[model samples]
Target: MDPREGEFVDRMGLVMERFGGTRTMGRMYAWLMVCDPPHQSLTELAARLGVSKTAVSTVARQLELTGMIERVPTASREHRYQVAAGGWEHVMKVQFAALRQAVETLDLGLAAVGGDRPEQRARLEETRDFFAWTERDADDMLRRWRDSREDLDR
Candidate 1:
């Protein structure tokens, strides 16, 4: 890899680390984003990234699960991967689902706590409301984006 490319990969690694993912995951993503042909086998990824095949495989699986990357269909035994189509939109959807789940959990907590601790209950309620609002806004944003894209394509 060029020095510039290595720096970008390292920066992406830090970004992923901040989001609770391994540095390897970010590096893999960064490499895939810039690589020619936009797809690579596990062995190729490992060799280029200077990581073990096992590590590359593990991160690739995680990225696949999160809808950030996908396995390309091939007749050969070795699997290939590339960044998923609409990956950012998929990530936003995942985040919205998580926010909804958080709201549900907060509702349960509020119910269990009751009015016993007014301050805590208020805080929980506020948090739940925030999540609910954010979820609604995200849904609206996605809908608008789709609508705009359709208009542009027409």
Candidate 2:
């Protein structure tokens, strides 16, 4: 990789780390974003990123689960991966799902704590409200993205 490309990968790693992902995940994502073919085998990714195949595989699975990347089917045994289409919208959808789950968990917690304990109830309520709002906002954002995409396509 060129020095500039390496720097970009490193910066992506830092950004992912800030958001609770491993550096390898970010680097792989960055590479996929700018790679020539836009898809790569695990071995190729590992070699290019200078990481172990196992590490690359693990992060790739994580990214796949999070809707950030996808495993491309191949005739060969070795699977290929690529950045998913509609990347940002997909990410927001995944995040919205997570926030919905959080709200469910928080609701349970609030019920468990009971309304008698004002402080605990208040705290859980506030957190739950935040997640609820975030979920709604994510939905709205995705809707807007779709509208803009349609406009651009037209």
Best candidate according to lDDT: 1
**TM of each candidate vs. truth:** 0.88, 0.81
lDDT of 2 by residue, 86-127 (tens): 766776676678887899999999999997899999999999
Q: What's the CA RMSD for each of the models? A: 1.9, 2.4
The TM-score of candidate 1 is 0.88
> Which of the numbered candidates is closest to the native, going by highest TM-score?
1
lDDT of 1 by residue, 56-112 (tens): 999999999989999999999999999997777887898788997899999999999
Q: List candidate 2 segments past 4 Å from native.
A: 73-76, 112-116
lDDT value, candidate 2, whole model = 0.90
Off by over 4 Å in 1: 147-154
lDDT for every model? Answer: 0.93, 0.90
Kindly provide the TM-score of model 2 when superposed on the true structure, using C-alpha atoms. 0.81
Error of 1 at 58 (Å): 1.1
